[model samples]
Structures are given as C-alpha cells and as structure tokens.
Target chain A: MKTIRLLTTLKLALFPLALQAQLELNATASFELSRGGDKSHYFYNEIHEGYSDWRFGLAQANLMAAWPFGGGWRLQGRLLLERKQGERPEQLRLPQLNLQWAPQESPLRFTLGRFLYPFGAFNGRQLPTERTFIARPLAYSYYVNISEKAGFFPGMGDEVKVPADGNTLWGSTMLYYGGYAAGMKLHWEIKARKAWLDAAVVNGAPNVRTGLPGSPNWGITSRFSVQPRHWWKQGFSLAYGTFMERADINAGLEKMKAYRQALIGTDYLIGFGYFELSGELIAATYRAPQHLPEEESFAGKALHLKALAGHGDIRYSLPFLGGAYLAYRFGMIHFGRIPGRTDRWDNGIKRHSLAAGYRINSFLLVQASVSTQQVNEKQWARRQQAFRLMLTAFY
Target chain B: MLRMAILMTTFLSFLYLGARQEAPAVIPGPHPAGVSAVRNNPEAEPVPLLRGDNEIYGLIGLPRPRKWVARGHAYNKDGSKVMHSDDPMAAPNRNVIVSLHPLDFQPPLSPTREAAITQKDQTFLPCVLPVTVGSTVYFLNEDQFVHSIYSLTLRNIAIGRRPPGEVHPRKINKPGVIQLTCDIHTHMRGVILSLETPYFTRADADGRYRIRGLPDGRYRMEVFHLDAGKRMVEVALSGGQALRQDIDYTKP
Candidate 1:
C-alpha cells in the first residue's frame, strides 16, 4: 500500500509532461521459464517462497512514453509489471518517471523524480531489451547476509533456527535489485563529451529498495565515466548514506552517522570487433547494529561489516554466423569477520553464469542462460543451480 | 527569310534546354561514410545494380575534394599489424541513385521483385540497395550479434529477428529513399531506394548513369548520393530522341 501511494505521487508529479508535445510510445514485453529452486532455499528473495518446480510465466512488460514538454524539459515514464515463479502477484510498478531539463546547447542535464538513480554502472540498462542475459548479476540479485529490517546477527545461537520464519528478517542484497529510488540527479559532460559525471541524493540507503521515501536518512551516490573510443569505456562510482531506519534496534537515525553504508566501485567495457569484454568490482562496508535473536529489544552495539564483489564477462560473436553470440560470466562475493571470532559475519558466495543470445532484429531478442551459486558457509546450502530462457519483443 | 531564321533559332534553343532538363537529384555534402555508417566499407561494397541498354544517359560530376576527407581509422596500441585494420571510405561518385519519374502523375509501373541486403562482418553488403516500388526487401543477419534493420526516410519500418538467420520480408510501396540501420549496432548501415518509375541506374566508375524504356514524354529525374544531397531536372523527350545530360557538382 505504501509503495502504491508513492508511485501515484510520482505519477502526479510527472503527469504535466504529458500535456505537451507529440507523445512517443515504446513498449517491450518478455516471457521467461526457469527451474532449480526449493521451498527452503533463499532464492531471488531472502524471505520468500522459492518455488521448487519448473515454472514459467510472463516475466515482464514495460510500457514507456516520452514527451518533450518544450523549453528544455522532457518527461519519460515507464509502467512496468513483473512476475516471478511463486507467491508474489503481478503488480504494476512505475520504475521511472524522470523529468529532465537539458537545453539544446548545454552540456549538463538535471533529472528529477523517481528513477533507477545511478549508484552503479549497470543500473542504466535494466530492461530486457538492453540487458545481455536472462538473469541478473548475483551482485544485484543474490541475497547477502544482511537484513533491511532486523539488521545483522553474527553466528546464530542455539535459540535461533535456520531460515527464520517468524522474524521476517534475513540477509538482503547490497543494492535493491531493480528498485527505482526517488532522487534528483545532475549529469555533466566533460572532456569534450568524452566523459560524464552523475551525482544524486536519495531517500535512504541505496541498498534499501522501497519505493516509499519515508526514511529519515538520505544517501548520496555518484559515478564518473570516460569513453576514449566507440568500443571502450571506463567508470568509477561511490555511494554513502545512513541505511537503517528503525532506531529502536539500530542506532539513532538522524544523529548517528556512523551507522551507514559506504560503497565504492569500478567498471570497464571493451568491444574489439568480434568480441567484447566487461567487468565491475565493488567494495562496501557497513557500520550496522547487531543483536542476538533472543535479546529481543535492545539497541545493540555497532558491528563493522565489509564486503567485496566482482564480476567479469566475455562475449564472442561467431564468425560467418549472424546474430549469434555466446557469453560467460564469473562472480564472487566475500564478507568480513566478527571482531572477536575468526568466523565471518555471513556466507561467502560465488556464481558462474553462461548464456547464448541472438538478436533476430531490433524488435525481438532471445537469450538462454544457466547459472550456479555456491555458498561457503557451513550453516547454508552448499550449491544451488538454475536455468532460464527469456524472450523479449519490442514495438 | 529573316523571320524564318529567327523561328529556327528559337526552335533550336528550346530543343537544347529541353533535352538537358531531365531532372537529377543532386546533393552535395561531406561523404556519408564520414557522418553515418552508410557507404563506409569501400573494400567490399557491392556494386549497385542497373539496367543494360537504357532510356536516359548522362555523366554525373562531383568537384574533386580539396583537403578535408573524414576516414575510418584503426590504430593498435602496440602498433602491431597482427590486430589492426585500415577500412577505406566509399568513393563519392559511386553508389549514386538516378531515377526518372514522368512529369505527368502517371509513372510507368516498374517490375517489382524480392531483393535482399545481407548483414555480415558487422557491415552491410551493397550499402546502396535499390528496388522497384512495392518491392519486398529482405534483411538477412549474417553476424553474431542480434541486428535490427529500420529505416525512417520514407516509411517507419522496423524488422525484428524471429528466426536466427532470416527475418520476414517487408514490402516497401513508397517511392523514395530509405536509410537502413541496425538498432543494436549503430555502426552498421544500408540504404534502399524504392522507385515509382521504371527508368533508373547507378553511376559507373567515370561518374556516368543511364536509363531506358520511356515513351516520348516529359519526365523528372532525381540523383542522390551519400555525399551529394539531391538534384532534380525536368526532361522532355520527343520522337524517341536519345538525350545526353550532364550533372554538375560545382552547381551545389
């Protein structure tokens, strides 16, 4: 309900852009089929049912429209609906409603309202038409040993159970997978249009993906990219903010700046005719509150948490064959340890993904991928695997 | 005798201008290979197709370049020949499309057939592909990445890949120039010309073009190239007279 209200408010804010100019509409719909999840395993979500059988459905639909409301103001909006395998029902989501003010002769652009604000380099192309694979990178989709509501607890005690159901608390991803965060962003082109810098301030921790802007904490994210040629690009990113909203179990929200999440990253892309290579490395640390599951109501001491994640991909377009390419990616995530013990705070994870993609033309694309996840913690499952096929059509 | 002489002179002058008036769409600008992806591949650009013995014939002239010629460049970091390529730019006079349309609204219906522009090696073959009006042009993908072919010049047409190798053919009924480009690869481009009249041809090595099968009538000729914009001239043929017209690049 809160998310719906937030989307409505965003719609009303950007609705004025629809009043002028010729509305240009674009749409892309996708269907997906996948297997390899169980009821107890932490699937795409930390605290959700991991449907145990082969399942398929309309994976996603995006209806997008743009209006140049003259005077250097243009509005772009997308209404999206996504479905997963199990319990979660399909709901309409307004992931983007950005109003940008860029003049004909200016090198700078200002974008306002809810958007997939650029905290990382990959956020720019989240749609199926733009993405290369059927599944998201584990850095974004894989659940980590951090919680949005209950924070983090190191090494479960005898009173705690694995896959705790009653608490509704588990590890969450560092960044909300595809959630659009409301913010005002400024973009500047420098170095003779060869480089670009983007900076934004959002409602809360970039890792928190809620559509609502109820968090008292504000986070700042920035990234700079340089393109020396058509086939090469490099980028660096940084983000910092108070991530925890509940002060009762966390720290004091407004005054305690130490209870925050800070992230740094670098990414690069190189396309050398027949093949392309790309990769990103991210490092994040958190000064988050930690408490025992049995110690119900206390603002426990802060725990220093750190993580490093990196992914590399290489794609090759076969010679003499049109619109057929094979890609392989390797990714890994490692967590920091507790202060007094040699044990780590969360599970160390790694994933391998391989895919084959073909662009039939501009209007349609198809990709099939197989992915495997491995956890290095004794308390968690050792290995999990999934296979997915996706079809995307654009009009 | 003086009146007869004056009538003869006037008659001769009218015939001179009328014979040369067959329109050519002459466009003059930087080579399209410098700006857009069209006609960039010179080493392997397929020659434009044409009819043999034709109706209208002429030599198309473009001003010799002075200094600035934008070219495709490839330089390896280590300056090694093992991983470097030197892509040549398309010649200006080649790939020029010249067509004749009847001044009267009734243009002779040209035979239409299925034509294809193949996408291979991340570049389009035959950068300039011409077909008759209402011809179905098939875009075949021969490279590894998904490539979409769309043109915004005459019709807003976009073809997606349903099958890996071939796409469903799209018929182009409109008579004009269409700029084809891949949505995935911005660097790959091609052009398709749909002609309403049956008489049209491309320029030869010496900047010449010819057309055939017209029935002694007023016609409009159009000439277009990536570098040359568009040029138009009105032509009047009478008593089945073969005409010679020259297109100039100096006239802009």
Candidate 2:
C-alpha cells in the first residue's frame, strides 16, 4: 500500500513537469485470458497433478514518463501494475526508474537505480503484450528446490503435497528465473547504432523472500549485440550471482544457507519481408545442497546440477490478412544427471508449439496455441497435450 | 478433456471465420527517412487507373540486378547453414518512376485535384507520392495522437500541429521534389513529387510500367529511380504504334 501511494505521488508530480516540457506521457493497459488442459498421469504442466482450469491469466498496466534536461541529462520512470488472479497477489513493480546521463554526441550512457537485467532476451521479456506466445520459454519456467532437506517427490512422506502450478515457492531459498533487478548499469554503442555492449550489477536473483537488503548480495550481468542490418540482430549474454539466506536444509543435520548460480546464453532474431525467425539458447549451472537427508541425496552424494535449454520459432505474416500471422516453435530442456543418480526428476523434456494470432489493430491481439510435452527418458514415457487461447487488449 | 478441446476448437473456428470477414487496412512498414523511392504501403487508396487511347507499356529492364549484401549470418529455416547467393534473386528493381516531359501538351485538370497522405501507426502512408504542379496535397492525422507535418524543401513549409482527425492542406505551385516529414517521429518521412505533367506512373514490382492517354507524337521520356538516379530518352509514336520501349537504365 505504501509503495502504491508513493508511485501515485510520483506520477502526480511528473504530470506538471510533463506539461511544461511538452513531453509525451505513455500509458497502456493490457488484459489476457487463457485456458489449458493436460493429459498425463502427473499433471502435464506441473510437478504434481497436471491439470489447471480456465482462468484470467493476466491483467496489467504500464505507465511511463521521461523528461530531458538538455545537456545530456534525463530522468525516466516506468511502473508495471499487475493483478495475478489465481497465481499471486496484486502488486506494483518498478521495471525502470532511473536517472541517465548520455552526452549529446557520444554513444556511452550511465544509469542508476532499478533497471532491466542485461543478461538475455528472457530478462527483458516481462510483458505479455510483447511476447509471441502465451507460455514462457522452457528455461524461464523451470523450477528447482533450494531447501537443505532432500526435495519431496509425488509419493514422498506423510506430509501433504501441494501442486506447483507455475507458482508457489517454499521459501526465499529457491530461485525464480529472470525478471527485473536493481543496480547501476553502463551502455556503450561501439559501431554507430549497429553494435552495443551493456554491463550491470544488480541485487541478487528473484529469490527475495527476505526482501532486498542494503548491500549484502549482488549479481553481475552483461550483454553484447550487433545488428548488421535494419532487420537482423544477434547477441550473447552472461550472468553470475550469489544468494545468502539462512534455511534449514535437513532436520537432523546442520542448516545450509549459501548458494550460487551462473548462466551463459546466445540469442538471434531476423525479420525479412513478411517472415520473422528467432531463437535462443541458455546453459545454467547451480550449486546443490551441502547437506541433504540421508534418503534424499542421490546415493548419499552431493553434486552440482547443470541444465541446457533452447527454443526456436518461425513466424509468417498472412499476406491476405493485414495483421495476422502463424507461428511454430520447438524447445527442449535437458538436465544433467549425477553419477549413479536414480531419480527421474533430472530427466529432459521437450515441447513443440504451434500458434496463430491476429492483431485487430495496434492495440488488440487474439492468439491460440497448441503444444505437446514429452519426457526424454523412456521410463517416464508419457506425452501431454494442451491448448490455450488468449485475447490481449492494450490502450 | 476432449469436450473442452472441442469447445475451444469451435470457439477459435468462429473467431477465425469472423476475422476473415473483416479485412482491415494496415499501415505500411517503416522505411529509412527521405528515401522517396520506397513505397511499402499497398493498402492505401489506389491510384486513378489509366484508360485512354494511346499507352506506353514495356518493362524497364536493368542492366544488372542489384546485389544483395552479405551481412551477419542469415540462416535458413532448417538452421543448417547461412544461405548465400552469387547472383541476385528475381525481380530486383522496383518503385521506379516513369514520366514524360510536358513540353507542348497541357494537363487535363487543374491541380485542385487533391490527394491525401495519412499518418497511421507512426508511419506516413504512400511514402513515394506523385502529383501535378497545381494539385493540393492533404496531410491527414489518422493516428490517435497529434503530429507536426513539415517540409524543409525550398521555402521550409511547416504545417503546425494537427490533432487526430484533422487535415492540413498544402498547395504545390512549382515543379520540384518536396520531402515531407514529421517532427515527432524521426522515422516518419515521405516525398511529394510535383510534376508539371500528368502522364506519370510508377513501375510495378516486375519493372513494368504503362502510361495511358498519350497522343500520337514524338515525346521525351524521363525515368527516375533510386539506384540509377535519372535518365532521358526520345521516342516517336505513329497511328496505333503501341510504343514498346524497354529501357535498360543501369549505368555502365
């Protein structure tokens, strides 16, 4: 509530300044409604039962304002207000709120405050309106346990197990893939507007259970991209971070509190005529729990986990229809297995998606997608199929 | 689960059918500023069709096709290897303007015939435009926001701010190229060609052009395109000659 009030006050203050400077104030609201179904023994889209009913997927609004004080100084603020119906709470997020300095004749820029993480295209894809599909990429949606005790399976202990359907976190220990981060960033364009390099240091990953501290945990991310033509671009990114939180890993053993993660990714995009093609590859490595329950650890051995994920898609515009397109995507997530590890949880999964969308105009879009997910291992040989339809409107 | 899938499929089918029934006009794609030869919009109001007695119909052949630049890696659909070609693909030279110099002939109508250039989705429709010397061109703001249309040509004509649904008309008193731009959108640009003659036509994607309503006599043909700059040639037409002039405008 206090944060909301502060944001509202800041917006009110910027209104007069906007009028004085004759600046453009941008505001848009978007809504998404979708439904999906699964057909596997263990729910297709989750770690537990694989079924989720129809729901209002997302409702969000974006507000932004920028003011330039000549001589290379500019102030800009952007807020994202989201109402996650059945997923989480209604919250306000500051995607970008910073002061920037860029010399009039130079390509270098310095920024401070909360800014987007310059790791990969996934980190910057925070809005549903900007994404091509209803479901996020494979790596961005995967979940891993950060607890000290051995993670529970479907038929674990007497404790009640809840279905983890794209949401729900055990504690501040686990990690949520890429989102927004706060820190100082530097950007330099090397060769005109064709190439750029960016580096930033931000508060640790999205495992912020205890809230962001003054200066305890920090992460570093960097990216480089080159656009040789007006319609083509390619880039690479890297991120390394550490999270320090205290949690009881095992009941009978001492608690483990520290963890680290690293990532390397490459992305490519091209648009020619009425067709577009894009793809991304991400490889991540993270530390395993130091102490685990006797029966939970794989052969009572602790080992780091590594995963490789990638996705590629092709979209073609229907020449007959002004703003309609058809797209097909293929993605896979492969998890490395430890020596003598018997658990199937570390197996690989692949997904194939086909979607069609029509943009009514500049502010409205309707899309439908059908996808199939299958595990790589034959022991877990079950295929799950799902379908989703979404309508998004922005103003 | 099967029932739900069937229901969703039915709903989507209905939506698709409904959308197919309403074919909306789309804004043209973005182009580099001040490139008057590129017209990316085909949905704009069609040009008045040419139907009369005499016509000049022929393909404007290029001496050689423009070569495609090999930049960063451009992969094929299968992601195997980058597709490279030694020669250019089919039909390279497009958007070339073919006109005749109006020396002795007079235009049929006054320049009062008005044509519109609209602002939609932050892009100026009909990026490459041609009109008679006295024609009035109206710049209409069809977008949701305001746009300032200006031209820095000879006299520096500036049409202040035009709000949505408003139109600003400008008269062309002389024959010259007037480059139109928007102060708000740096990428929004267009060109207004004020020709003294009405016998002007743009070439199709296949480099074929046809200018009708020409009298049977000798005339000078002027060709304008981005790649080859400008060139002129002389041709004569007799009774029902059906002038077939294939011009290879590429410079040696």
Candidate 3:
C-alpha cells in the first residue's frame, strides 16, 4: 500500500510534464465477471461466488507512462491496481519500469531496470487492450507442482508432497506469468524489424519468481526470430540459469546450482487479411534433486524431471465492426514421470478456450469468453465450465 | 458562427458535388504565411477541363502481378464475414499520382483549397493524397476515438489532440513529402504529396489516368508511386493534339 501511494504521488508529480507533452501517458481499467469452475487460481481470473451464481472478480487499473528523451531514449513505467481476491488483494503492482536507448535508424537497442523478460513472442502483448481474449494462455498461467521455495515436489515422499494449487510457495509458471524482472536486455534488428535477436539477463529463471540474494542466481534468456514474409514469422527461445530461492539452497542440498531450470521453446505467427494464428511450444526440465529424503528422491535414481507445454490460438476479425474478433485457443501442459512411479509426475492438463471481443473504439473493449479444463472434466463438471465477461477501457 | 457557417456550407457543397458524380470544385491558393502564389492571381484561374484538345491519356501497367489471394468479400451463413476483411486485394497501381512539369514554363503558384482526410476504421481514409504546396488540409476524426494527427515534416502545423467529431486544419506552405501518422495507432499512416506542379491527378483502379488543359509546351511527365518512387519522361505537345503514354513499371 505504501508503494502504491508512492506511485500515485509520483504520477501526480509528473502530471505537469505529461500536460507539456514531455510524458506520454495512458491507462487501462478493466472489470471482470466470472462464473463456474475452480475459483482458486492465482491472479483469480476464475473467482466465482457459487456453482449456480455469477461472481464479480476485479476492477483492475493500470497507469502507464513513457518519457521519450532526445536521441531515441525513453523511460517507461506501469502501476497496476486491482480490487479482487488474490495473494495481495487490493495491492498494486509496479511491474514495468525500464530505461531504454534505441537510437533512430539503429540496429541495436538496449534497456535496463525492471522490464518484461524478453522470452516469448507474445511477452510484449501482455496488456488487455493488445490481446483479443479474456482467458490467458494456460501455458503462462498454470502453476506446476513445483514449490518455488522447496523445489519440484514430484517423486517425493508424503512429507513434501506438493500442496494444492494457489499455494504461494508452490505456484509457479513456465514464464513466471509475464513477470517484470530486474534485468538488462538488448536486441539487434534489421530489415524494417523483420528479423531480430533479443537477449536478457535477469534476477531469476522464468519458471520460479524467486532469486538468490547477492546475485547467486541469474537467468540468461535469448530469442531469435525472423519474418521472411509479411504474413509469416518464426522464432526460437532458450532460458537457462540457477533459479532456486535462497531458502531451497540453504536446505542442506548438494550442488544447488545443479537444481536449475532450463527451457527451450519455438514459436510461429501467421497474420494476413484479417486472420491471425500464433502458437508456441516449450519444454523445460528441473535438474534432478542431488540430495533429499531417500524415499522422496527415488534413492538418488531420478533423472531430470521434465515439463512440456504449448498453446495455439487463432483469431478471425469480424468485418462488420471496427475491431471485432473471435478467437479459439487450445493449450496443454504435461509432466514427465518419476523414476519408480507408474503415473506421470502430474496430471496432464488440457484447456479449450473460446472468446469474442469487440473494440468499441481505441479506448474501450468488450470481451466474453468460456473455457473448460479437459483433464478435470469430471471434477470440473461440478461447476460445468468457466465463463468470463470483461470490459477494458484505455485513455 | 462564421466558421461554423463555412463548415456547414462546405459540407453541403461536398454533398451536392458528390451527388452529381463529379469532383468538387477545388480552388487552391497560396498560404498567407509563406509561398509566392496570390489567391486572386489571374494565372491561377480554374483551368478548363479541355482548353483545346491537348491532353495525356495512359495506363500504368505494373511489370508483375502481386502475389495476393482474394480476401473475404462475402458473408458466412452466421451473419459474420467469411474472413475478417472486405478487400479482394487493391486494384493495380492504385493511389499513384501523375503530373506534368514544364521545364521552362513556371506555372502560377497554387492557392489554398479546403481538403480533408477522415480518420475511420483505425486508418486514415485516402491514404495517399495529392495537394498543392499551399493548400489547407483538414484532419477530421470520424472514428469514435481521439487521434493525435501529426506530420514531422509539417512540424509547424501542430494538432495536439483531435477528439472525435472534431476537425483540425493546417495550411501547408512548403513543398515536400509530408507523411502523417497517428500517435495512438502506429499502424495508421498517410502521405500528402505536396507538389508545386499545377497539373496533377491520381490514377484510377484500372491504372488509367487522364490530364487535360495542357498548353502547348515541352514538358516532363512525372509518375509517382508510393512503392516505386518517382520517374520522369520527356514529352512535347503541339497543335492541341492528344498524346498517349503508357507507363509500364516492368521496363526500365
């Protein structure tokens, strides 16, 4: 709350500069209503009142600004506020704060401070106004059975079995849910930006949002993409580094650095004549536990425990409206098996999402969506499915 | 009230001319702040469509056809478009402006004319525009969003924030390529081809064009395309004869 107040004060102080055109300012406000399905997800996009009752979730607002200096330099920041049920209800987030130097007609650009980890092709389009759907990609939102503090829980004894979903200690994403990390990033580009190479060194790996103190854990991420044609693009990315929290490192573990996360991903995008299709596939592995409970660590027989995830979505613009579109996405995340277990480490989850959105103007958008988790078909049938209605406004 | 009356009059006149399937009467004058042309100069009178019989008629044929597929122009059974677009690819060589420049003949400077570029559907309508050096152009926001229309080349014409249903005007005095863009929508782009030449007209969907009322003279015919840039060809018109020139981009 103090941070939020400070950010508000900072914005108030900068209003005079914004009015003078020295600062480009914009904001996005969103309200969401959801019903059915599990409501315990982190970020609480699926919060619901009852099985038969619709529930209101959030009144989220993001204040964004940029200060463009002469000679192609800029400072960017975002302050996010949301009223909802979550780990930090009603708490604001300062996710995007960065300084960039991109000289005009230059092939290379540099950025520092806290910024979006340049990992996936879609990382840059995290704002609701820029995307077409209400439900985020499951690959980016789903938390695995890995404890952010104690590490992966699969192939372990009952003492360290992974807790339920939404546990603060165990909730982690393949991409840290697009977290803005303290980092430095750079990109080299050419051919009207048809091709580029982006690389970043951040505080921690993308899967776990934890970092060791004193720079003991640093993640290096890189991506290379090319658009050989106006309608097609392809890229590949890789991230690797020691990512365990200091707590896990101090837990009598051997070779703590070996318990890192390494991920490899490839993505493609196709857009032409009002139709857009994009997809990415990523596979990551948390190096095997060097030392743990004899029964929990499979007697030191467990190899690298792996997770494979991907998502594909397509959007078709509706010609009748200024910016109306319908989109469908399918995503899945499946885990590798333990050394002695007859089943995979975790349930292989699949989700199918359908959404329709209309941009009333440049500043406002309305979206309605529904999604079903196929892996929990039986359990989730209690709520039937999840439906979401959202309104997003920008100024 | 006078400004409002002029706006209403202009709107009514535009409707009247549009109803008749004829182009509106464009009386251009020099911008008062700069340029050499006077508004009432005798030489700046509206040229007849056909003073004599001297004219240039031709088609601009592209060397190769674009590799574009037919987009959605039909509707689905569900009342939605089959595809998201209402375009079937642009007509060949569209938006290219053709003008004739005389080597030794200095035509009278142009006076200002009221013209407009409407902001609609996240784009600047008439993406390509041809204007005189001193014409007054208005940027109108027809969409339901505010647009910050600006041109780095015409930096003096400052239109900070143009809300919907509002119109902002600027008198362009310099002669050069003025590219306009919206700060809100980076994909939206427009170009104002400000030429000093008096005889200028854009090509039609069929890549065909016609320019009339050229006095007997030696001239340089300039073909301008957004992608192919500008090219010059020399020609002479005498005896009020009609000249035919076909510009083929495939050839040198």
Give model 1 RMSD, 1 decimal. 18.9
Candidate 3: regions farther than 4 A off: A1-21, A38-53, A57-59, A83-89, A154-168, A210-216, A248-250, A288-303, A376-384, B1-252
lDDT of 1 by residue, B82-167 (tens): 11112222334566777777785564354444355656655666566667777766555544434555564543354533123443
lDDT of 2 by residue, B1-252 (tens): 489558656754554565344323222433223222222332122233322467788888754532322111110000111112221111124436787764555546345244656676665565556677767666666555555555645233455345566554566676777766553343355666677666778777677888777766667887766435567888776566678887876544
Q: Candidate 1 falls in which docking quality class?
A: incorrect
lDDT of 2 by residue, A1-395 (tens): 99999999988876665444533245556554444443332223322222345545455677665555445656666677764322432777666667777876677888777665676665555554556776667766544433223332222221223223343333222224325567888888888647889888877644332224453566788899987665567899887776544323234332233455678889987754345678899887765443323453332334466678899887655534444567778888876665356653344768878888865544566877777777665544444555667676654
Q: Lowest summed lDDT over 10 consecutive residues: which window, candidate 1 chain A?
A: A156-165
lDDT of 1 by residue, A285-376 (tens): 98876655555633446778898888888765532234556777877888888777798876677776788877666467788888766777
Better of 1 and 3 by TM-score: 1
- Error (Å) of candidate 3 at residue B100 is 30
Minimum summed lDDT over a 10-residue window in model 1 chain B is located at: B74-83
**For every candidate, how close is chain A to the native chain A in TM-score?**
0.86, 0.77, 0.83
Q: What is the lDDT of residue A158 in candidate 1?
A: 17
What level of docking quality does candidate 2 show? Answer: incorrect
Clashing pairs in 3: B28-B111, B28-B112, B29-B111, B29-B112, B30-B111
